[model samples]
Target: MSLPITKSRFCISYSISKFSRFFPNPSSLSSFYSQSPSVDVHDSQPPSDDVQDFVSQFHSMFHMRPVPPINQFQKILGSLAKMKHYSTTISLFKQMELKGIQSNLVILSIIINCLCELGQMRCSFSVLAKILRLGYHPDVIALNTLMRGLCRNSDVKKALTFHDKAVAQGFRFNEVTYGILINGLCKGGETEAAIKLLRIVEGGLCKCNVVMYSPIIDSLFKDNLAKEAYDLVTKMISNKIMPDACIYNIMIHALCKERRIKEAKNVLAVMVKTYVKPTCVTLNILMDWYSLVNEMKSAEHIFNTMTQLKVTPTIISYNIMISGLLKNKRVDEAMNIFQEMPKRNMVPDRVTYNILLDGLCKSGRISNVWDLIDEMHYRNQQPNVITYTCVIHAFCKNYHLDKAFELFKIMMKKGIQPSMHTWNIFIDGMCKGGRLQEAQKIFQYLLIKGYPLNVFCYSTMINGLCKEGLIDEALTLWSKMEDNGCLPDTVTFEIMIRALFEKDEIDKAETFLREMILRGLMT
Candidate 1:
């Protein structure tokens, strides 16, 4: 039976467990000794006496002297692996090696499976080689574990290579093996190949299992190949295999991505009819999709329906609502949702603050946004790049250049580099303020930094000079703008025409107007 952990004891134990390996001295000596006559490499390996004391300690801790049976040891290792006791795994593997237990197929597969599951793929492959070197048959499970790792790392070709080799070695494909292959092929958009593989499995001597079909359907969904996914679902049912929640969720997500809301709802209905329950991931897909399409009301409805169906929304679900409301310009509603978050027992993350700031900034309420920022700081929430950028752009729009610059400096201090958008805002503001010389310095800085001055920047400077009645200067800058590889916008043409006319240069004005008409910039 598992013992209950109190809060204080848990905290103490957690810290104590962090240094768990100080007791397990694997290497006796630590410091490298070059002058100590490079210890003669032994042709024969050292004896196990070095680890005998720790081996006995392991036995004492468990109150067992004899090693457990293969299955029993497997169960214990599985539990340890699940607990992510990496040190324990390393220790056990080492002890097993020392005992000459021989890393056979079963043991190697189990350890490799655990390592692969933990994203330690390198170690898994090392064990694979060790098993092979030991002259033992590397089982299908071991090969499958490696394939799963390769697939996870998006190394599809490598996985396929292993699959071919395994199949050649009389390894019949299992659900996991096919699932990994189908997932990789679907993700890689090798749909034709995936279909071909399916045909091969169908025609080959190996019988098609119910397990392989789910991932193929799920992969079809992943690729937004909804029709294929739907057909596969039908095939699963006709095969007398029960469609699981995973298959249903995948189809629902596919329908959502395709913006087939009605069909998505239909899929959900079928899921319910089949007595398959929707998990949090299923509801999240719906809510997130609805949010993406700006259908906040529908998103909220689905969220409510999810709760009614006993599906608890994770923090991600709430974030979707907040984000959708903000993007739809329902700032007040977004804030209301944020304010009432504590009522639902949810804490505000950086995303929550940034979303609120974004809505406020876009609506031209920088003062309130500043207040919100202060409140966030008061609440011990730090501003991130999104928050800083939003506030800086807001300042630039309100001609609060000083404040915007301050935030830019603060962002740099926080190790958050200002993006091109941030630079554009300041440049636009500077041009508008008749600070062309300062703007020119910034322009050059941007150019040297490899950031091209976008069309807006070019037009803004030209328009600024034109408004100042500096026709010659504006024309010169316009030519320099073109030389810098900045394309002239429609606004740039209009500004040039206006500048020429203001200077009473009638001929030049007519010439500029002709260019504008020739470019089809204005009707």
Candidate 2:
């Protein structure tokens, strides 16, 4: 289903090479506009109030008795670009040219950036050629924008070739230039290429810095090359390129992911000792990890330390604490934190509500769940699929199967499609509650509806059949699971084998156990 990396890169490069040849001439901006497809306003959402106001102001400025200076036009264009009204920006640029307004490098570069953002690479290249035709030497920013456009198109190889040509034309680039190229390489899964480029640029005109090294390091960690990433950091230190908060955060996050808490702590210590202040993100990462491993005391300490360090805790910070406490069954503590959020001027988002609601549901505090859901509505945070799923799960857990089914129908009526997990929870509930026939009906319905059933879904049904003394039916479902291409996992095999052994089918149990081992599903 996936192309080989080499073939994928070659395809991208080849496609880019083909498009590179069709660049419109730069002498006439009108010709360039003619070649490009006109931006259809109907295709995009209507502009916001602020954007509308800006457009009115732009028109007034444009039709003035004495037009504003080029810098004034540039400012308006830059602001529009920042607002992500790329099409509008390009249209306004055309207006300026038609009015015979002399264009500067800054204005041209802005147009190039807008084109790049709009994915009009051919138009972007045409703008670059215009910059050259007007005897304006493209600065590092202009060339960087062009290369970034190439990279954004997934033509990193073409970007490299462009970089080589720029160097040949005697144009000097800066650290930002290399940063874009390195980032592109890493994003394209060319970490080794990024490192090699970093080596080539080190101690040269554009000395390599954290900006250049961070992406490669992060990519290395993602590829599970922890030692290589660590060594790269050491090399950066030796070269006096001190790691900043961003760099330290990357290291801490990666180490925490690997469950290397001690190493993560050491990195934090080094970060602090070196006077690199830990950010809110750094503290949040530690808090999340501690909470996950049930080290609530450590999580609490980090939460408190945020204020001491003058790092303002964000809504995310509160959400993490609440989720963590609730996960560890500290429902009351979570509720306390949730209540305290308003005092801190933080409005709880949907995720906050879902976490607390699910906790309350699991804790059998069903009485207060409706009140919280009403509060969500009052706050304009309407319950979505996850919210409905939580309530249904709670009802099912409390043996209120009728209420669960009722809520499921209400969810469907409200156009909230049930997720696979929702179906799984409901089916598992029915099976455990001795409603095997209902579970089978729902399972069959899911299959008929073409749901991409996973091993867990099939295994759940098979387990239910076996428990209901339908061994032949369970065996049939097991065969159907494999034929459907949902291969049995270790859990599925263990469930089947255990069910068979309990039913005194020792021969079938041993046969399944041997097959599971042979398939490497079990050790």
State TM-scores per candidate.
0.74, 0.82
Local error of candidate 2 at 296, Å? Answer: 1.7
- As a whole number from 0 to 100, the lDDT of residue 192 in candidate 1 is 60
How many clashes show up per model? 0, 0
Candidate 2 local lDDT, residue 440: 94
Worst 10 residues of 1 by lDDT: 5-14
| Residue-level lDDT tens digits of model 1 in 32-57 | 11113211233123324433444344
- At residue 89, what lDDT does model 1 achieve? 48
Q: What TM-score does model 1 achieve against the real structure?
A: 0.74
- TM-score (C-alpha) between model 2 and the true structure: 0.82
Per-residue lDDT tens digits for candidate 2, residues 1-523, read 2111222211212233344354565455457666443333631346788777766777788688788888988888888888888887777777667668888999899989888877777788888888888899988888898888888899787787676566657887888988998899898888887787777677364687899989989999999998999899999989999899989999999999989987998999999999999999999999999898889999999998899998999888998999999888999999999999999889999999999999999889988887998999899898999999999899888888988999899889989999999999899889878899999999999999999988888888988888888989999999999999999999888888998999899999999999999998877
> Which residue segments of model 2 deviate by more than 4 Å?
1-19, 22-49, 84-88, 91-104, 118-122, 133-135, 374-385, 413-416, 466-476, 487-523
Candidate-wise lDDT, in order: 0.69, 0.84
Candidate 2: residue 90 Cα off by (Å): 4.0
